[model samples]
Target: MKQHIRLLKTYLKPQRKRVVLLVLLLFGSIALDLLAPRQLSLFIDGAEAGASLDALVTVAVVFIVLTIAKQLVVAVAGYFSEDVGWRATNALRADLADHCLNLDISFHKDHTPGELMERVDGDVGVLSDFMSLFVFSVLGRALLAVGILGLVFSTDYRIGLLLLAYSLFVVLVLRRLQSVGVPHFNALRRTKADLSGFLEERLTSTEDIRANGARPYVMHRLSEHVENLVRRTRASMISARVFSSVLEISLAAATGGVFALGAWLLPGGSISLGEIFLIYYYTQLLSLSLIVITHHLDTLQKATGAIQRISELYHTTPQVRDGEGGSLPDGALDVTFDAVSFGYGEASRTLDEVSFALPAGETVGLLGRTGSGKTTLTRLLCRAYDVDAGAVRLADVDVRDLRLADLRDRIGVVTQDVQLFHASLRDNVTLFDATIDDGHIERAFAELGLSDWYASQPDGLDTVMVNGGETLSAGEAQLLALTRVMLRDPDIIVLDEASSRLDPGTERLIARATERLLKGRTGIVVAHRLATVRKVDHIVVLDDGEVCEAGPRERLEADPASRFSALIAGGTA
Candidate 1:
């Protein structure tokens, strides 16, 4: 509860002025609404007393005008309320997105994109309802109920006391019911998130599912998730409806009791007809207001569940912290791994005591079999994960001692799996960096021998890549990835099986581009094919997380005992 209040206060602080104006408008509407009943009572009493027709017409017009004004005020108040709610929730959505982006790769590996979307968007959307309805439905109705009670009490003490006591009883009972329903709502949210994640995964893998003939199994799994979600949702709804029914029945009984008491008092002349009518009107008003409040209470319970989940996300601390260290030096930077050892969680070390170095302006080929730590070595250089022991360095300075953005900006990586968004070709190459101009893009394409490919597109850079780059072939995607790396112009480059997807024709083009791209720059090529690394200055071969061979490529290839030579001879490179 404290956390919920704190979050509300933090988000509401920026919209304080709008909130204040909304409150004033609410009061105006409620005050005007309450006046109608009073004027109706006046007209009733006047008619009974044989008052002037003109005076009665004046009261009738005033009553109609007040009702219309109250509606207009309510409409305006609702507008302000929605405005504030959207702004606050949108701000929260942006914050969640930024926080998720800053989290480490391990965090992303543990959570799917769909689950994160639910957390960042779906949960915040629930809070939007809570904010918009909170003012009018919750607070306004409560205030209106109290005002009705006060007006009734001024007319007759006995009836006022009964209604007040009934309102209190209803509120207490509903509060207890909400406490019981909250856990169910929380469970429902979890199941819904799971369902969303499953759907997203299945949708993205539709092709594989069909190709592997696993559609039936996938459908069965999806049905199980849907069943669980339905069960949880039904349970939450049942609890809410049960409590709401109780409130409705209690208010109905209270209304009957009020009317019965007013009848007995009216006959005895203990209260005037006008006074009895006023008391009955206020009683109905109070009952309706309480009903609205109860409904809002149910929504509040759902929002409470959302708030708890969102708060948990906010509390998740990234395992990898950003460094506040200085920037890297300009020009080609040497890459070094000093006896580094690291693993994913409790798993055995992926890279165990790995030590290697590539001098400034030198290119090295990292040769290894599957699961032999070649890719892990490149990941360490990029600071995807901190070393379990020892340090990774650029230009003799520990990578950990450099700001995360600065370190990543100095090292460019191009992996086999090229990720292109559904955006314009220019946006894909520049990654939406507005600072990169057309000249840089043109030069990158020309230097990579993609001038003909660029010219083939009628729209040129403005051409939109759709379906995650399905518009381009595998080789074309690789070329685009290379162009992205070239445009960044980083000091050090890491190519992890980047050329494995290209055909012979494209491979030759990329090889020339790679050689030209490595000029005066440090590079590490994690090669699966020997031909790709034949021209590299040196080679480092890893076996089971340990480097077994390291030296000039010519020397390593000449040595019969060298693992690099054995792998080459065995045609496994």
Candidate 2:
């Protein structure tokens, strides 16, 4: 409850002006609505006393005008309230996106993209509607209820007290019932995210599922998720319905009781007919307000659940902290890993006390079997994950002691699985960095042997890549990634099997590009093929997270007993 209130304050603080305006409008609307009941009573009593036609007509017009004005105020207030709600919710959405992006890769590995989307977007959408209702419907109706009760007491204190007692009773019952619904709503939210994640994962792998003939299995899992969501949703709905029904029944009984009391008192001259009618009218108005309040309460409960989930996300601390560190030294930076050790969570170390160094403007080849920590080593170099022990350094300064932006800005990474957005070729090549000029891009493409591919495009740099670069071949995507890296011109480059996905012809083109890219930059190549690393100055071989061989490639190749020689002989390099 405290967390929800804190979350509300944090998001709503920026919209105080709108909130105040909405409240003023609520007061005006409620005043107009309450005045209509009095006008009706005055009309009825004046008619009973044979009042003038002109006076009656005037009251009728005033009542109609009041009704229209009340609705207009409500409409204006609702619009502003909705505007404020969306602005605050969008702020929260942006914060969530930024937070998720800053979290460590391990955190991302534990969660699916669809689940995070549901939490960041879907949950906030629920809060938006609830916020609007809270500002307009809940507050406005609550004030109306209080105003009616006060007016009823001015007419007849005894009946007003009785109605107040019944209102409290109904509120207590509904509050208790709402407590039962909150947990169910929370569960329902989780189930919905699970369903979203399941569907997203399945849709993304549609080809694999179809080719493997696993449609039945996928459908069964989806059905199970749907069934779970339905059950929880039904439970929450049933609880809310019960609360609404009880409030309706109780309010109806109270109205009947008031009517009976008024009838009995009228004969004794304890109350006038107008007063009886006033009390009854106010009772009905109060009933409507109570119904609105009850409905808003249900919405509030669901929003509370969403707020708790969102707060949980906000409270998640990133394992990788951005240290207040200095910038890197200028020029090509030598890379060094001094007895580095790391792991994912409680798992065994992926890089166990590994140590190696490459001088500035030198190239090193990393040869390792699967799960031998080649990629992990590069990740550590980039500070994607801090070392569990020892240090990774650039130019003798620990990577952790360099500002994250500065460290990453000077290093470039190209992986086998390239990511291309659905955007224009210029945007894809620059990755939306407006500072990269078209001339630089054109030169990079030509230098990297991608000019022929570029010429084949009818729209040149304006051509749009669709469906995650489906229009381009795998090798083309890899080349595009390399072009982006070359444009950035980082001092250190990590090529993690960047040419592994290309055919022989494309591989030759990429190899020529790679050689040009590595000319003046320090390079670490995670080699999947021995031929790709033949000209590398140094070689490091890993077996079970330990460095088994480290030397010049020619020397390792010359020694028959060396791990690199054995790998080549076994055709495993």
Clashes of 1: 0
Query: What digit string (tens of lDDT, one per residue) describes model 2 on residues 1-573?
Result: 687678778888899998888879988988998898788888888898899999999988998999999889989998998999999999999999999988888888888988999999989999998887886577777778888888888888889888989978977896788778899889988999999889999998999999999999999999999899999999888888888888889988999989998998889988877778878888888898888888776687788789899999988998777768866768898888999998876768798999999999999999998899999999999888999999998889988877778888899999988888899889998999899888999999988777898898879989998654358888888888899999988999999988776799989988988998898899999978987898899999988888989998899999999989988898877
Off by over 4 Å in 1: 468-470
Off by over 4 Å in 2: 296-298, 434-437
Measured against the true structure, the TM-scores of the candidates, in listed sequence, are 0.95, 0.95
Clashing pairs in 1: none
Q: What is the alpha-carbon lDDT of model 2 when measured against the actual structure?
A: 0.87
| Worst ten in a row by lDDT for model 2 | 465-474
| Candidate 1 lowest-lDDT run of ten | 466-475
